[model samples]
Target: MKAIVSVKRVVDYNVRIQVKPDGSGVVTDGVKMSMNPFDEIAMEEAVRLKEKGKITEIIAVTIGGAKNEETLRTALAFGATKAIHIKDEGEVQPLTAARALAAVFKKEGASLLIAGKQAIDDDANQTGQMVAALLDIAQATFAGKVDVDGNKATVVREVDAGLETLEVDLPAVITADLRLNEPRYLKLPDIMKAKRIPIEATTLADLGVTAAAAVKTVKTVPPPSRSKGVMVKTVDDLVAALKAKGLA
Candidate 1:
C-alpha cells in the first residue's frame, strides 16, 4: 500500500509575521520558512505506518513555486520514499491545493492519503476534507490516533465535544492533529541526505488539471495589540475597572 502525504511551506512558527506595508500580504522576504508544523506530524505518521508494514511506499507532495521544494526535501528526510512538486507560480488557494492534491492522489494510485488538519499560516482546515470530497472517498479529520488492519483503518479524532473513534475503509483521507504523534528531529546526516534526494517537479498544466477559481484577499492586517493591564490593589478596584471597560 502506498501513502501520499501532502506538505506545505509556510513561515516558521517562531517568526513574527508582518503584514506588507500596502496590505497586500504577510512579508516573506528574509523571513524564516519551513514545512508546515501539522504537515510534519502528517509525515511522521506516514513514516510510522510504513515502519509498521501498513504502507509500502510514502510519496510526499507539495504545491508552490521554486521555494516549496525545500519543504518536500524535509519530507524526504522524514522518511518519504519519493517527492512530487506541483509547480504553481501564483497563489494556490485552499480549493486549488485540494484539486492539485487530488490529482496527485489519482496518478499515484495511492491507497492512503494523509495531510495536516490545518496549516498555521491560514488555519483554513479545509484542504484534507476537500481532497476527500474530490476523490469521493472516506475522510477522517483531526485524527489523534490511527491503526490500520487490512483495508480498514481506525481513527480517533478530536472534536469539539470529545474524542470520536471512526473506522473507515481503505483509500481514505486522514488529517493529522497535534496529538497524533511527536515528529522526530532530523539529524545532521539526514539533513545532508535530504539535499541529495531528487524531487520530481511538474506543473499543474502537465497534470492536466486546473484548480478552482481562487478567492482573492482584499487586504492583510495584524491582530490588534493587547491593551495594557491596569494595576488594581483591591477587589473593588478590579470590579470598577472591569465595569469601566464594559467587560464586567
Candidate 2:
C-alpha cells in the first residue's frame, strides 16, 4: 500500500516565538525551522508501518518555497521513499494547503494519508480533516495508536471524554497525536543519502489548485505578563486575597 505523509515546515518548537515588530505576524527570518513536531511523529509512524511490511511505499510531501526542501530532506532521512515539493511562496492557509495536498494524493494514487494533528506555528489543526473532506474519504484525528490490517486502519485516538477507537477503510486520512510515537534521530549516513534523492517539485497551479483568500492580520501582540503572587499562610488568607483581587 502506498502512503502519503504531509510534512509541514514550521518554526522549531524549541525556539521562543517572537511576534513581528510591526504587529504583522510571527518572526521567521533567521529563525531555526524544522518539520512540525506532530508531522515528525506521523513520519515515524509511516516508517514503522513500512518496516512491518504493511506499507509498500512512503511519500513525503510538503508545500512551500525552495527552503521547504530542507523539511523534505529530513523526511527522506526518516524513511520516506520519495519526496514531493509543492512550490508556493505565499502564505498557505489550512484549506488551501489541504487542497494542494489532496491534489498530490490523487496524482500519486496513494492509499493512505498521514499528517500532523496541528502545525506548531499556526496550531490551526484543520488541514488533515480538510484533506479528508476534500477526498471524501474516512478520517481519524489525534491518533495515539494506529494499526493497519488489510484494507482497514484501526486507530486509537484521545478525546475530551477519554479515548476513542476507530476503524476506517483504506485510502483514509489519519492525524498523529503527541503520544503517537517517538521519532528516531537522523543518522549521518541516512542524511547523506537523503541529499542525493531529488525532490520532485510542482506548482499549485500545475496541480489545478489555487490559493485561497488571503488572511489579513489586524495586529499581533504578546500576552500580558502575570501579576506577582502573594504568599498566604492559611486558606482563610488565600480566600481574603482572592476576594481583595475580586477573583473569588
Candidate 3:
C-alpha cells in the first residue's frame, strides 16, 4: 500500500504571534516557520507504518507559495521517499487545498492519506474531512492510534467524551491528533540526503484546478488582553468580587 502524508508549513509553535497593525492577519515577517506539529505526528506515524512493512511507499505533499518546499524537505529527512509541492501563489482556502490534494491523491494512486487534524496557523480542522468528502472515501479524524490489517484499518480517535474506535477500509483519510506520536529528530546525514530527494512541483492551474476561497477573512484581531489578577486575603473579598461580576 502507498501512503500520502500531507505536510503543512506553519508558524513555529514556540514563537509568539503578533497581529498586523491593520488587523489584516498575523505577522509572518521574521517569524520562525516549521512543519505543523500535528502534521509532523502524521508523518511520523506513516514512517512507523512503513518501517513495519505495512506500507510500501510514503509520499509527502505540501501546498503553499513560499517556504513550502522547506517543509517538504523536512518530511523527506524524516523518511518519506518522495515529496510533491502544489504551488499556489494566492491565499489557499481549505476547499482549494482539499481539491488540489485530491487530484494528487488520485494521480499518485495512494491507498491511505494521513494529515494533521488542524493547521496551527488557522486551526480550521476541515481539510482532512473535506478531502474525504471530495474523494468519497472513509475518514477517521483526530486519530490517536492506528492499526492496519490487510486492507482495513482500526483507528482509535480522541474525542470529547473519550476515545472512539472505528474501522475504515483502504483508500481512507486519517487525521493525526496531538497524542498520535512524537516525531523523530532529523540527523545531519539525513538532512544531507534529503537535499537530493526529488520534489515535484506543480501549480493549481497546472493541475487544471482553480484556486478559489470558499471563506473570506474580513479581518483578524488579537484576543482581548487579560486583566490583572488580584489576590484576595479573605473569603468575603472573593465573594464581593464575584458579586460585582454577577456571579455570586
Pairs in steric clash, model 1: none
- Score candidate 2 by lDDT: 0.94
Best by lDDT: 2
TM-score of 2: 0.95
lDDT, ranked from best to worst: 2, 1, 3
Name model 2 segments beyond 4 Å from true: 242-248
Better of 1 and 2 by lDDT: 2
Model 3 per-residue lDDT at 214: 79
Error of 2 at 83 (Å): 0.3
lDDT of 2 by residue, 210-232 (tens): 88875665888876879888789
Candidate 1, residues 1-248, lDDT tens digits: the string is 99999999999999999999999999999999999999999999999999999999999999998999899989999989999999898888899889888888999999889999999999999999999999999999999999989999999999999999999998999999999999999888888898899999988888877866768889999999999877899999999999998999
| lDDT of candidates 1 onward, in order | 0.94, 0.94, 0.92
Q: Per-candidate TM vs. native? A: 0.96, 0.95, 0.96
